[model samples]
Target chain A: MAKVNRSLTGTMGRSWLKDAQFTPLAFLAPTIVLLVAFAFIPMIWGLALAFTDYPILLSPKFIGLDNFRRLKDDPVFWASLRNTFSYIIGTVPPRIILGFVVALLLNQAIRGRNILRAMFYFPVVAPLVSVSLLWQWMFNTHFGVINGILRMLGRAPVPWLTSSKYALPAVMIMSVWKTVGWNMVIFLAGLQGISPSYYEAAEIDGANRWQCVRHITLPLLRPIILLALVISTINSSKVFEQVYIMTGGGPGYSTMTLVQQVYHSAFQSYEMGYASAISLVLFAIVMILSVIQFKYLGARTDE
Target chain B: MLRKFSVALSTMLALMLLISFAAAAAPAELRFLWWESPQRVESIQRLIDEYEKAHPDVSIKLESIPWDEYWQKLPILIAAGRAPDIMFMVSGNVQRYAEMNALLDLREPYVSQEVIDEMYEPHRAMVTYQGKISALPFTLTTVTPFYNKDHAAKAGIEPPMTPENAWTWEEFKLAAAKMKQAAGSPYGVGLGTRDFWLLPFIYQNGGAVLNEARTGSAINSPESEEALAFLQELVTEGIAASPVDQSVGDLFPAGLMPMSFGGHWDMARFETVITDFDYGVTFFPQRKTSGVGLGGDFLAVYSKTPYPKEAAEFVAWLTSAEANGQYIAENYYLSPRQGAKVTYPSRQEEMNLAQKQAELASVRLTADRAIPAWDKFLQVIHSEFQMVMIGDKKPADGLKAIESAINKTLQ
Candidate 1:
């Protein structure tokens, strides 16, 4: 009787374990296969090509590390690297600060709060291509609305898009406008997740609103803030569309960035191997940055 | 028996509909890809329709890609071994394609020397690389300077009507100064640093992009510096608009600026948009000689094409006098073929001007602009030109930098 009972229980346990593991795998197979085929396989292929001399029109010959050796002495690559770094530093901080402050403000009791929130979030939902195109007209050196208004105010016309001095800043301005709303939405959710009871408790302990925010709200929002920064770093580093559409990376290549260089080398010059080498350098830089962020910032909250 | 007879008759009629007029002959599908302005799509489609009607056994599939994206797509298509049978080629495109052994040589087997000689010299030279005719020039364009007639009239300056009578560098500057002094603020000339605009100045100053052998860049020489200095003075003196002030000057009505450099496509737009004012176009103002940059689109058959004869025949028909005349009339392009007779029915005057421009272009069109590294060379030149135009770099330094970059690319 004891043996029969044990055998039945073992059978039941095995069946339960099988069903638990089988269902999710069956559901996830298509997505996993697609990711491997499209993303992983291409990445590996690109990695291999980074070491070759594969001009797109010509047959690719394996010339190991030659592309990378050329990159060491390339001045244009260095200039583009500088411009990309400047773009990120110039745009990302403002975006995050503006977004968080607005999100904090909107979280409070205000008039037509939902409507205000919706207005702030509208640009986030709008397409980047359309937004950048609109900005292009707005930044036109002569007949743009901004210059028109400046002229009406008795000021000299500014060459917003044409001048090398101003073109990168103009692009940065557009990027900030496009991105702040997205970060605001994310920060808003994090702001809302904080319990009001903690604030009340702080208030009871003779803490002012600023003090309570300093001690409680910020600490609670740390993980979300870190995540937003990491994502912002990735997005700003990979900025291509805005620079491409607005400037064509010109006026002495003042606004040329890394991804634009990759695109130019690959598509325009037909130097695929060289482009891949540039891309790998970017990928490694991004990885190092991401790892640093995860280690220093992510460790604080995940623990 | 009567019902069975009726069913059999109906079945035979249905089978007849399934069979084409060519009687079970398999159609050879030729994919033809090109970039076209929206206005020209209808005309191109009409040409394709005519070609298809002429050859019942050959079906031509027309694909249109955006001009800005064509280079990016073309290489991928060729590398993937899925390139179209026939493609539209431009001056800078054929050299690369020919180098890759991707284009079929039209000199022998496909076309004869007599037929090639029928094209304008510059247009013919444009499609030739390594002594081989790689493609056939279908349309020609020479950069022409368009001036606002009303602006000139207001400034009491009568701009010259032909290259021979046009302003010298000093005279052009004086006219610009007079216009600015009269009109105020928007300036007189819209300076362009692009290849068509800047290269012509180099040619007009007795400079070419390269030596006759096309061995190296000639832009580092004294004449090239003189050409750049002329432009540099206009920029720094604030006589003409710099990119910092405005790029190619966004002045509209095509009539606000006294002069602007443009191509044939601008002719169509000016006709429509310049209704508020009147504009006149003339040959590029000369320095040492009257010259203009000549460039155009061409047709090339892919070496991998399954039906080379049919593709070549179609391209030949498309570039023939009758087809090209209609194409030019509808599309506002100048013809490349000798005696192609491109008469823009209502605008016979513009057609006459186009002929004059084409004639001027041939005098200085041959250069290193046809090198396989043409695109990269352009990039370096464009950057250096911008630097000089913006008053940031000295003309000598800019030219030296451009020459160095070109040498690096060539190596």
Candidate 2:
């Protein structure tokens, strides 16, 4: 028994130094180094920057909690923070629900399935800058196609991009339309992974289509759904381009997102330290949200 | 064989030293960088060619970056101690670069009293920082009201073509409403959505953006509130377009807007875009005074430039009356120099009014640049102003909010 234990320990301890194990790490070294250089180092640097007064053109001075203190009284900062959360809430659930529904429908062996799938996925492949620009034109109050359609329906044209009340909603609608396809593709992959035998078994047990979906499909797709939810939430929280291009965080601070604030502070204002502080707050919020999502959904997913 | 080898090596070494000396004797290479547009680039290149021709001992390498990317890259280059020998700066950024000690002083030997006297007082004030001339402004323009002739005729209103004939605040608003009603224009006037563009209104109302010492916002005063309230009324009544509704300056060219504020520089583009409508440039509408915000680019020498003397010489020459007048005339821009005689090929009538308006340009327009992070302050002002214009907040409330935000930056 002692010899067997010794053998197990020796093999395990020696395995990492062997060519087989060492080769994988050698291959991964470039990626690990790159990740550390680009991602982790900047993150740490950004955190450190939050504690200093760094004007981009000047040397950074240690300033303790001054930036954070300033942020507390900053109305724009508060408005942007509120907008970010609203954006996540407004975008993520709709994207996930719509994506899931579309995925379930497309999973059927219908005619033109491939063409339909490609059409839905087209938005995911289009460049975001152009997409945002196109949507900006489409959201124009008087001349836009959207407003034209509303007028044709005998409805008053909505001040989609101009009015503060509708600006955030307009941006969210564009974002959902742009990204729902991505989630659909993800859900489609997950749906295709589920075994058809489970449905057959449910059918043999005299289960109806709804029962089969409820008992079999949903339970199996639980982990994928949780994954999609978390990813969508994080992505929605970081929404910037659409708001930036479509509304420019205005008519008031209506469509301003946290990321736009970060860009504004850093590049526009050159207040790198304050920008870093905003970034840290954003990171912390995203981290907390992701942890809560995983904690709640991950448990059910595990079951 | 050793002796022969030694002699040959000595000969090669001497030749190498000669080549090194020849290289050291080459003309000083100075880098001049500026943001580019077609006419501006052509005019600048023309000046550079002339400068090079006159100063054979100095060579200049001209470089241009597109406007948006230029601001982003310039600061990084300056921070890295690789700034161009001479670079173009705007009046609003002069304070920033001066505060950073990135600009060379042009007061003493570089700029003469004759040259200083030739420049307009407001232009001189724009380049001055703490009693030192930090830059030499070349071309100057001011925001003026441009109107479509057909629309004005249709509305039966005469657009202000001179300072004396400029419309009063009430007349301007009433005329805008009239134009909207008669011409079927969506937005009768397009007030540009920018802090600088808004400054003309504030200054015309006898209001100052910042206090005497530039420590805090003075825009909370009754004068400024009244000015802003007028603007808010124009926007709320749909006499002027909101930035949200359409791209502000585009509507005029599209024939959707009857009147709009623009600089002399915009005339070139209008000459192309307004093919259908005959548009004429005029002075901004009057309040208490015909004060308009100045728009100009300055030539500044980098403090750390190795060829400071050459850079300063080029800057001085480029901004000289003869050189500057030719460049401005060619590009249809008003010269910043009071002594410079600029003549445009066409639109001489509009150019004359633009020149008159340029002289009336306000010093208070670029005063907020003295405050650090003025861009950020402008963002706050922009949003608050938008709220006021959209009737989401009162003018007084918006001004107070702007003051509070600006004061935070001051601290």
Candidate 3:
């Protein structure tokens, strides 16, 4: 009887192992294959490339720390860092606040409120390149519609893009215009999710609309706002196409971003290893900023 | 059931992968990259078809990028080790690529010395690097003065023809001023801050963007300063409209500006479009000397190309006098080959007149005289010149800034 029981147990265990081996793999095969082929393989290749002095035509030579060492003195890399930080700082707060305010305004019962919302959201849905080109024409110092209006008003036409002093700010203005609508849509969704009962309760407690928003809506929207802020921060940090299309990193590199610098270094300047080092530095900065934001602002979400 | 599904999916994926691999390895293909107008691209396709017919075993894949993205795209492709076998190049970038040894030398068995001599001296020199030919010269561009004939006639000033008869810088300024005064508009000459238009002024003033060694920026020299000051004077004195941030051709054709500086590449288009007014080409005015930036395209093969011999053969053939002359005549470019005549459309005389003006406007820094640092230094000079034109900085201060910037780049 004991031998029979042991034999049955052994058979059951072998069958269970076979089932376990195939089931999870069957469920996860597609994802595993995709990750290995797309993400893991490319990442390994890029990491290996970073350690080598490689011009595409020549054989790659292992030059371990040399690329990193050169990154220390690359002035363009540092300028790109500063420009990226400025862009993040300039764009994020205004975008978030404007998005929230516009959402709040549209939430009120007004005539053609839906139409207004659509108008506000139109820019976000529009193709970015088209928006950039349109803005470029609008900001043209001479024949552009923006200057045309300014001239009619007897105001001196501002050199919207040509001046180094105004190039970054002008780009930021376009960025804000193009992005505020999308954020507004997200905020609008978050606002709608907030139950009206909370506002009713606040009203019963003798609170004004401002008080209701501060005491109730603010707390409820914290998670959404934090998410928006993080997303916008990442988006603004990687800003490339608008600046490239509008300024081409011109007026003396005032508008050059880290990505543009990397592109130039790796391709135009033929310094791929150094570009990789710069990219690694950018990655580190993005990671650190993400960690800090999560620790401080993201914690409020759980509460 | 799960086992059966897993087995089928894996088998399907494996089969797909095998098919893709087979497709990838099916044929040896030559990738050719170029940038030209859509109409011109069509013309190129016709020639490519002929080439393919003669060499049935070889297949060519053409990738035509827009002009604006061509420079940016080529470098990226090169860095990625996916650059096309044959590609379009320009004088501005020839030095950059040649210095990096990214281009194949064409002076070997493919291109003959006789063929090289047949190319205009400047054109041949532009593609020559370190005593070796690096590319085939396809076209040559010289900065010629374009003026609205109606505006000139109305002002009672006939446009000058020869360099000697060409209006002096002062006379050019006065003529522009008179046009503005008569038109009751603050428009004289249209000056756009593109390097092509600005470099000629520096050349005419006997100012080199870089010193003779091409090691430091010479834009801060007295001659460069005078040139910058003269342009600023044009703006400040209302002899030319404030250099608008638009293409010079766009402004001129719109009848917003009377005189502009441009190249012959746009001549065909201008002739077709400017039916509202008569326009003519004249030699650009001189300061202390006459100079124009050499502008045009070059055809080059990549160093890593698998079929360098065949690629070189195609390049050589394309740049041959017969082929180049046809191309120029078709596309309105000035053929770089010596004595290659192009028959223009119904306006043949006008075309000849424009060609003569271009010859007269030809600057000292032809393809032969260009160095590797030419483009970078020219960019530095252009930025400084733009700053001066906009009254952001004095010409002297701007020149100093430009010199330092160029020196830093060279170092």
Candidate 4:
């Protein structure tokens, strides 16, 4: 009887090991294949391409550091970088602040609050290309409704997009307008997730609305704000489509973003290698910024 | 085991289905890519039907994309080694692609010597790259003066009929100012901040954007500076509305502006829109020389195309005088074929006006006089001209900057 029991136990143990081994592999196989094919392979190829002089039609020649060397002196690339930073610096804080403020207002007990939330989020769901074209008409220098309103109010018409001085800022304003709804939704989610008991406890302690927000709401919302910041930062850095459809990187490259520069170099100019180098630089910048934000905000969240 | 066997059987069936579908189609498919214009598409489709009747073996597939996405899409298709057999080619981009050997040399198969001679000299030259015919010109347009006859008459100036009779820069400015004064709260000329309108002036003043070899800048020359200064004077002296806060088309047709620089394409729309006022077309005003910029489309075959023989045959037939005239006439375009006649009774005046503009284009599109680095140079010109228009840079400074930028691009 003891010997039979021992054999059965050994068989059970074998079955457990066999089941454990194949289950994880079976589940992970698709994701692993996806990562290898789409992410890992392309990244490796892109990195390899950065060292070559590869124009799509010609045979790629290894020209070490030539593309990088060119980037140092390319005024357009530098200008694009500056414009990108300007877009980021100009776009991020306002998007976050405005988004949070709107989200806070919506958190109030008002009639038709849900409808108001839907109204704010409408632009987010509307197609980008359509909205951009609509904005183009709105921003039209003469016949545009905006200018017409401004004229009626007895103000001089602003060259919202055509002027180099205002082009980047104009694009930023549009960017903020298009995306604040999305960010507001996230902030609202964060705001709602906060326990009502904390506010109640604050009220019991004679805390005013401002003080309650300063002490309880902000600290608890830190992680959510950090998430919003990281997302907006990354997004603003890579701004392309709106600027592309709206300006085509013009009024003298005032609104040319880094991604536009990458696209032009790679496709239009057919300088794929040089474009890859620029792309790598952009990747490094994004990665560094993300890491810093993660460390700073991650530690704060932990505390 | 039975389930696995069933799965294998289904996969085999699917493969067989695909194979049969592929093998069943033996029709001659001629893929044509072009920019979006409903009228143009309808006309081209009619031509295609005619061709199909003539050659039952051929079936034409037309792909239309908007003008903005057309150029961007072509390169991607080329890089993917799946470009359309026949596609639209602009003069500015033809040479660049031809140099890369992306375009199929049409000189040998489709463009015979006799057929080539039958084409207008300017049209033939526009598509010739490195002594090989790279494309066939479909329509030709040149930037010319489009004037509101009422406004011009009010200014006490008759519209210039010939190149010699055209206004000088100074005279043109005075006429514009006089017109503006006559029409209260209206502008004289609509000065757009686009390179197309500005290039004719730049070239007419003997200021080449790039030097003869197309390797360096010539825009910093005294002539270019003079040209830009003249344009600036038009804006600053209130002879023309600053492009900053106006649409030239809206302003021009409303009889708010006397004259605007545009091409033949605008003629059709203008004729319909400007019923209240009479308008006429004339040559762009000359300075040191007569200069006009070439604007039009060309047809080319991709080098990677599998149906080169069929593609060449179709291109040859389409560019024949009869077919060319039919297509151009339907679309209200100026046919590149020498002596090709268009019969659009409703738009007879506009057609005649386009013919006149085409003659001016013939003079400008001559290879000997044409700027070889035209595309690259124009990018710089657009930027520099914008700066000057906006009063951000002095005209001379703008010219200098454009010259530097052009030189850099050429290098």
Highest lDDT: which candidate?
A: 2
Model 2's alpha-carbon lDDT is: 0.85
List model 1 lDDT by residue over A149-244, tens digit each.
999999998888777889899999999988898899999999889999999999899999889889998889989989898999999999999888
lDDT of 4 at B269: 72
- Tens digits of per-residue lDDT for model 1 on B169-253? 8888888888766766466677665787777778888887776666676788888889888888887787777644333545734
Q: Kindly list the per-residue Cα lDDT of model 4 for residues A12-42, writing each as its tens digit.
A: 9999887787877999999999999999999
Error of 2 at B86 (Å): 2.5
True contact recovery of candidate 1: 0.54
By lDDT rank, best first, the candidates go: 2, 1, 4, 3
TM-score of 3: 0.84
| Residues B309-371, model 3: lDDT tens digits | 878888887777676676677667777776778886555655576566556543345642366
- Cα displacement (angstroms), candidate 3, residue B370, comes to 4.8
- Write model 4 residue lDDT over B105-220, tens digit each, in one string: 88765567877787677667667778878777777666756777776777687766666677788777877788777665346777665665676677788776666655677778
Interface DockQ of each model = 0.48, 0.61, 0.14, 0.23
By summed lDDT, which 10 consecutive residues of candidate 2 chain A come out lowest? A15-24
Give lDDT tens digits, candidate 2, residues B140-209.
Answer: 8677678888988888998877688888999999988998888797788988877767777888888887
Give me the displacement of residue B228 in model 1, in angstroms. Answer: 1.0
Residue A231, candidate 4: how far off, in angstroms?
Answer: 1.6
Give the winner by TM-score: 1 or 3.
1
Candidate 1, which segments miss by more than 4 Å at Cα? A1-20, A147-157, B1-24, B243-250, B362-366
Q: How many Å off is the CA of B44 in candidate 1?
A: 0.9
Ranking by DockQ: 2, 1, 4, 3
What is the TM-score of each predicted model, taking all chains together?
Answer: 0.91, 0.92, 0.84, 0.87
Model 3: number of clashes? 4
Higher TM-score: candidate 3 or 4? 4
